[model samples]
Target: MFLQNVFTSYIFLVLGLFHVCHAQHITTSLEGRLAFPNKTPFNITTKITLNSGEYTTYSRKDGSFIIYDVPPGVHQLDIDSKAYHFGQIKIQLLEESMDSPKCLEYAYPGAPKRVVKYPLVIYAKGTYEYFETKKGVSIFGMLKNPMVLMMLFSVGMMVIMPKLMEGMDPEEKARMKQQMEAQKDPTQMFSQMFGELTGSSEDQTAAGTTRRERREQRRVKNQ
Candidate 1:
């Protein structure tokens, strides 16, 4: 009985060590390539990361990269490039080295699985907007603003309509005058009745809308 108990204990110890050793050797290499648009300038310092900062690798001059000894599990593979942006991909690897690799959409996890070829073919989305665009208030940009356009329209109507009304007879001129006064600019009327719906003000609502505006939105849903 004593000899049998020793043998049983020895077996369990051996199995535990074997399991640990096997898990340690289960790592595989993650491979992928970085591609950019034709004639797009790219720096040679592009790097790839897995599971945030668990494992990191840099791409070669020819845009090829590999993360060595990646442990078998799910990982978020991402590229780090200053001038460009790349898609975040979800990669899953199993214990079997023969298990083929696939890229899944990391951003939309609940969406359908998007399986792509192994040795991932990563493409550039576009360049990052590093600097704020120069805002010197050009005539074209100001004209695009709702407030500016409304003001210009109201001024033009006030100036031109009065002189044009001079040619009309008394009844016609009075009718035209009433129509002009009654038909206030819809934009101006909304601003006065509800509140400022647009433009950048320091105390403006974070959503660019007020509680009343949201109620108005829900009201307009039937329309």
Candidate 2:
């Protein structure tokens, strides 16, 4: 019974030692703020990787950031911003004492960038207008011109209306086609109307009868 009691005490002692060593390797935290070239604070996302693990965090509008449980070693820090570009940087972390905290401040090296530039003109009248005119009628011109827009709309309707009328009855479609064709022949309709209004129909008929009578007389004379 004494031997068994001694063995149990040894087991408990080993467990306590292991717990102490584990406590010594406990996690550490790093806190910091991000800044710009002009010392302006902006919201940003950051990705950090170290031998311990990978972590991601976002800085608030005030540019404050905090990362927890980072191992003491070399790490990679990446700042995420499309307009403001940043390359990866190597970060060094030191072992944190139980009484002290690791705090840092970081600044993004990127600044504001312009993507487009307009041409400069000086001492030349109409030079810009001349260059624009050389490019000739663009799609914007067609869109803005009422006559061109009307023609485009008419052509579009011509293409779409046939398909729409396909679902219509054949008799209705035919009648519509006839009416459109008549409307298209404005000159012929106008001539018929003028002839009726001025009695030109009677004049033309009388003229034709006289020519036939004259032709008959000439035939008789020739015989």
Candidate 3:
């Protein structure tokens, strides 16, 4: 019976030591909610950093926070907002657990206090945006079209014709100047142009007829 009593005492002594060690290792935690003025826990983000062990945590979407395993002592609680201005606060943690939520409220600066005002940003459609919507055809489609080739050829002629005239000999320049003067009278110019075309056609016909006649005469002599 004495041996059984001693065994029971040893078991109770071991359990007591376990309890004491668990209580000594108990850690403290901080819970809080951050909010902006006249708002219910805005979606703004908040950063909390405890100087001890450099522990840190960001606030939830509802502006709630829970920092675990905080060292129990006087520590600097550095607080920062992603969209507001609430400086830091010093926290004195003396308890193993804090169930009451720490509530913090901050206000944004007034419009007059805003020194760096950002300009309004906007996007405008370009003038050529409509052409882009046509799907490749409106932009480079003309490059492959016959009309574009004709237009380019006409423009090239217009550019080269003046340079050609400038480089002509003095006699050719005189002739060209006379032609320009003739062009001043549109009626006379059209009449003269038509006469020249008909005269050249007649001369070609006459030369072809003379050649045929010579061939006929040669055949007769051979026969």
Candidate of highest lDDT: 1
Write down the lDDT that model 3 would get: 0.60
Between which residue pairs do clashes occur in model 1? none
The lowest-lDDT stretch of 10 consecutive residues in candidate 2 is 118-127
**TM-score for candidate 1:** 0.55
Q: Is candidate 2 or candidate 3 better by lDDT?
A: 3
lDDT of 3 by residue, 55-112 (tens): 8998777777777876556655555544454534445545543333232221233322
Q: Show model 1 residue runs off by greater than 4 Å.
A: 37-43, 107-113, 132-223
> For every model in order, what is the number of clashing pairs?
0, 0, 0
lDDT tens digits by residue: candidate 1, 1-223: 9999999999999999999999988887888888876844444669789999899999988788888888788889888888777778888787775357656854333556566778787778788897999889689999999999999998998899879988998757755654455456776445433444445432443443466678899899967
Clash-forming residue pairs, model 3: none
Query: What range of 10 consecutive residues in model 1 has the weakest lDDT sum?
Result: 200-209
By TM-score, highest first, what's the ranking? 1, 2, 3
